[model samples]
Structure formats: C-alpha cells, structure tokens
Target chain A: MQQTRSIEMGTGLFVLLGMAALFFLTTQTTGSNSLSGSDTFEVTARFDNVGSLKNRAPVRMSGVTIGRVTSVRFDPDTLVAEVKLEIESQYDRIPEDSDAGILTSGLLGSQYIGLQAGGSDLSLQEGSEIEFTQSAIVIENLISKYLFKQDSGSDEK
Target chain B: MLRELYFSFVDFLRTFGALQLFFLRLLANSPAILVRRFGLVVQQVYNAGALSLVIIMICGFFVGGVLGLQGYANLAKFNAEDSVGTFAAFSLLKELGPVITALLFSGRAGTALASEIGLMKATEQLSAMEMMAVDPLRRILVPRFLGGVISMPLLTAIFSVIGLFGAHLVAVDLLGVDPGAFWQQMRSSLEIGDVWEGIIKSMVFGVVASLLAVWEGYNAIPTAEGVGRATTRTVVITAIAVLILDFMITAIAI
Candidate 1:
C-alpha cells in the first residue's frame, strides 16, 4: 500500500509537471505582443487593396515592429479600406509626411504595413492620419502591365 | 500468348481478392476485439508511456537545441536573429516534434511488441490460447493496438513541450537572448493550427506503428529465427509507414 501510494504520487507529479510545461510552451509561442503600460496611440492609413492584410498583423518600420493593425474596414463612399493601426508609446514620433505602404515580406508571404520615414521635422500626433499610403501591388497585375508595355514597344519598333 | 496473359491476369485478381478479404475480416472484428482486450490495452499503454519518457526527453532536448543553434546562426547572418523563435516553433510544431517522437517510440516499443508476440507463437502459447477458447487477437493484439493509440498523442504532447522549453533554454540561458523578446517572437509566430497538426500526426503514427507490429507478430512463423526476422521487419515497416503517413497528413492539412 505504501509503495502504491508512492507510485501514485510520482504519477501525479509527472502529470502536473507535464501540464505546467505544456502551458508554458503555449503561452510563449502565442503571445508575441508584450506591450506594457497602456500608452497606445492610433493612426489610420487608407489603401486601395489590403491584400491578405489580416487584423492584428504587425506594423513595421525598418524591420522592427512598432504597432499592429487593430481593425480594417471599407469606406462605402470611397471604396477604400480604412486600416486603423495601434502604435506603441515608444514609437510615437512618426512624422506627418511618413508614407505607409502595404508591402509583402516575400512572394507569397503575409502583408504588413511598412512605414517609410519622411524628412519632415513636424512629427504626427495621436489620431493623425498618414495620407501618403501606397496600396498593395499585385505581382500578377505588374506582370500583365509589363507584358502589355513590351507589346506596345514592339509595335513602335 | 493470349491464354498465358489471361492466366496471369486471373492470378493477379485472385491475390488482390484474397488481400481484400483479409482486410475486411480484420476491420470487421477490430471493434469487438478491442472491447474485449481493454485490460491488456491499459497495460501496454502503461509500459510504453512510462518506460519511454526518459529517452524521449533527452532526444527532444537535443533536437530543440540544435534547431535553435542552427536557426539563430542562419538568421544572425541577416541581422534577423529575433526570428529564431518563429523558426523553432515552425520546425517543432509542423515536422520534427511528431516525426522524431514517433520514430523514437517505434524503435523502443514496436520492436519489443513484435518479439514478445513472436516468442509466444514460437512456444505454442497462441495455440494453447485457441484450445482454451480464448481469442488471441482480443487478448494480445487489441491491447497493444489500443495502448499505442492512447499513448502516442500523449507522448507527442510531452515531446513538443520539452522541445520548446529546450530551445528556450538554449536561446535565452546558454545564448544571450532576452527572454521577453524570445517569447514575444514565439508568440507572434506560432498559430494554434501548428500544434494541432503535430498532435494529429502523432495519433495517426501511433495507430500505424501498433497495427504493423501486431500484424507482423501474429503472422510470424513459429521459430526463434522467425521472431528475430519479424522484429526487424516491424521496425523497418513502421518507420517507413510513419514517414509516408506524415507526408500524406501534411499534404492534406496544408
């Protein structure tokens, strides 16, 4: 009976340890955004095509993520996607003239908002709109345009 | 020439029909056999799960460490060392965690199962069971099959956890990565679907390994030499089956 109790205790410990380890792994693997202190600022970028731009995807500047896309909606009047971005407090000094482009990481990768810093001394405040935004350029559209241009050039020749 | 070709075609069909009949019988009796062999299944699960933990832990740790080191080195070349978490999670959850764990389990458990059952056959113990009105399939094979089915996903879950933690230790403790940043990258990178894929693949692998081992053992000829041959075949066949099934599952899932 003593031996059996010890074995039971050991089994219980093993299970508990395993569960703790599993929970740690799950939390570590899924919690990327560790923004602290609730000092978030919002900004908006309008684009013609978000193109696989998922909500909560990172907003990066110079390959360092400074924010995430909070929500994406279409302006019924303009037929443009109004992407609201949540910028962390530390990266609040983005200039008014900064350009936000919907860029792909690779050929078939997810879309992210890439901010190109402008040479403006006047920094944008919270709730300021980034007006100079470039929509996602589909590779297929670019290829077709290039082919058409080649045909037109051949006719000229 | 036409007569010879017709004979060969008939022979092929006859063999195919025999195989179909065997499979149908196996499938028909599987559930009933499994129900009757519940105790045996529990014992097999206890043996496989408890005995295999230490080796699985060691292998999981080393595999995770190597992945982290290699991933960190490659990403460092491009000044993107932060992406190591993503690489580690992707490799562990999608491919290495399930396949390596199953392969290890097959080596440990699969060989043991085949040899044990093969020995029973060689000693006329199976025939004695038949004389005693005991169904050997229910008494022996079903327990092992059910044990493997139950243990595999549990083992896989354990392996994935150990592997991730091992990578974290190597990256943050051994190497000079910030724990916060490493975890941040990992969290941002992995999806729930990635972990689900590993667990699902492991369950399938468990079923295949157990089935193959039981089949090989049951069909083994009654000789010491035959038991050795069956053991070898069980390991080889199960390993190959695991890889093939891994590919099929990945193709479907992805």
Candidate 2:
C-alpha cells in the first residue's frame, strides 16, 4: 500500500512536469504572440512577388517589430500576392498611406515586411490595405537584368 | 528453398494477423480498464515515465547542446550564427524530440516490459490468471499499453523543452549569439502546426512501441531463451517502425 501511494505520487509529479513543459512550449517558446490575440488589427498588402516571406514573419516599422505577417495568399483576380499583416493595437497610429516593402535581413537571412510610415492624416485601421508596396527583390531577376543591360550595351557599341 | 520461402511467407502473414488481432483486443479492452483499473495504469505510468525521466532529461540536454554547437558552426560560415536557435528548435521539435524519445523508450521501458511479461509467462503466472478467469489481456496488457501511450507525448514535450533550454545555455551563454535574435527567430519561425506535428508523431510512436512490447512478451515461448529473444525483437522492431513511421509522417506533413 505504501509502495502504491509513493508510485502514485511520483506519477502525478511526472505528469505535472510534462504538462508544464508543454504549456511553456505553447505559450513562451512559440511566437503565438500579441498579433495572434484580439489586441491586434489585421491589414492587407498586395505585392507582385512575395518571394519567401512566410507566415509569422515580423512586420517592422523603422526596424522596430510592431506586428507579424499572419497570412500570405495569391490573389488570382488581381494577379498578386496578398500578404496579411496583424499589427499590435498599441501601434494604432501607423499612417494609412505607409508603404510596405519585403526586405531581406543581412545578406542571406530570412525575409520580413518593412513598413515605412508615410505623411498622412489618417491612421491605418482594421481591414485597411496598404496601397504603396515594394515586392521582394529576386536575385535571379536582378542578375538577368544586369546581364541584359550589359548585352544591350555591347550591341550598341 | 522455394518451399521454405513459401512457409516463411505464410508464417509472416500469420504473425501479422495475430498482431492486428492483439491490437484490436487492446482497443476493445481500453475503455473499461481505463475507468475501473486506472490505478493499475498509474502504477505502470510511474514505472515507465518517472523511472525513465532521468535518462531522458540527460540525453535531451546533451543532444540539444550538440545541435546548438553544430548549428552555430554551420550558420557562422554564412554569418548567420543568430539563427542557430531557430535551426535547433526546428530540428528538435519536428524530428529529434519524438524520434529519440521513442528510441530510448523502446530501449528502456520496452525491453523491461517484454522481459517482465515473458518471465511471468515462463513462471505460469499468465496461465494461473487464465485458470482463475482473470483475463490477463485486460488486467495486464491494457494498463501497460495505456500507460505508455499517455506517457509518450508528455515525455516528448519535456524532452523538447529541456532541449531548448540546453540549446539556449550553449548558444546564448557559451557562445556569443545575440540572445534576442536566438529566441526571437525561434519563436517567429515555429508555429502551432509544427508543435502539433511533434505531438501527433509521439503519440503514434507510443502506441506502436507499447503494442509491440506487450505483444512480443505475451506470445513468447515460455522459456528463458524465448524471453531473451522477445526482448531483443521488441527493440529491433520498434526502432525500425519508428524510423519508417517518422518518414511517412514527415512526408505527409510537409
């Protein structure tokens, strides 16, 4: 009987420990953060190319992380990538005319959305779309354009 | 040779059929045992989970440290050492945590279960239970199986959390990686779906490992050599099954 009780106690502790670990992972480790909660407002931005910008990538204003990219989907009718940004409610004063650009970190780091606030009287509200956007810079396209420019220059010579 | 091959194929089919039948019986008996014999399951949980926690934690820490070290070295070449946390977390959560835990579980608890049940069979305890009409499958096997299933995801979760801590210790403290970048990248890159994938994989592995252990032991020839063979087979088969299932699940998930 004593053995069984001890076994039960040990098992209870073990189970609790496991639960605690899982809770930590869910809440702390994974970045299901302020953007995921109701304390954020969602806005959409359209890009000709989104490159490798994935969901949950940071949305930064002047290099300060203010939100997350909640979703990236193709708009077949508009023929562009529609990226959803979930901005924290505290940053509710972002101008409606801000420009959203897909920018890479360092030389070969992950891509993130950069918001350059524009001079506008209105603030970005829920469901408002950022009008001015710069698409992701594809390396291959730049290389091909450079090569094509060189080829045309030689042809002119 | 052809005749021998035919016989072996037939034997394989028979064993597979029996294993399937055993699994069915387990599922059938689970609910009743879970309700009435909950204490038995708890005892088994203690035996399988608590007893094994020390080794699991130690291995988790070392494995995480290795991942951090390796990740740092590789990412440093690209001047992206800060991404080591993301790399380690992804690897640990998606692949290593469940796979390593299951492999270790088979080595530890699976062998113990097989040998113990095989010894009981050898000692005629199972037969005595049958004589007393006490359904050994219900009272013995079901509890053990349930305990293993319940313990596996929990163990995997603990392993991953500890692994993250170990990685943090190595990357942030030992190395000069920016702590903010390390954690921020990991948090942003990982999603609930990735965590769910790990949980699902662990649970599947748990069912397979526990079922294999109990099944091997229950059907072992009631002899010393047979018991040893059953224990050995439990480890070997569980390891192979885990790898194959991991591949399939990963492919489907991705």
Best by DockQ: 2
For every model in order, what is the iRMS?
Answer: 3.2, 1.1
Residue A101 in candidate 2, Cα distance off native in Å: 1.4
Candidate 2 lDDT by residue in tens digits, B1-254:
99999999999999999999999999999999999999999999998898889989999999999999999999999888989999999999999999999999999899999999999999999999999999999989999999899889899999999999899899899998999999988887788888889989999999999999999999889999999999999999999999999999999999
Candidate 2 lDDT, A65-90, residue by residue in tens: 89989899999999999999989899
Please give the range of 10 consecutive residues that has the lowest summed lDDT in model 1 chain B. B18-27
- The reply for model 2, stretches above 4 Å from the true place, is A147-157
- Cα TM-score per model: 0.69, 0.92
| Collision pairs in model 1 | A29-B187, A30-B187, A31-B187
lDDT, candidate 1, B1-254, per-residue tens: 99999999999798557645544555566677567655455567666665677888899888889887988888888877777777888898778988998898888888888889999999999999999998886677667767777677777767877887788788778877777877766776676667778778888888778777777787788899999999998889888989999999999998
Predicted complexes: DockQ each: 0.25, 0.75
Question: What TM value does chain B of candidate 1 have?
Answer: 0.88
Task: Return the lDDT, model 2, position B112.
Answer: 94
**Winner by lDDT:** 2
Clashes of 1: 3
Work out candidate 1's RMSD over C-alphas.
Answer: 7.9
lDDT of 2 at A113: 96
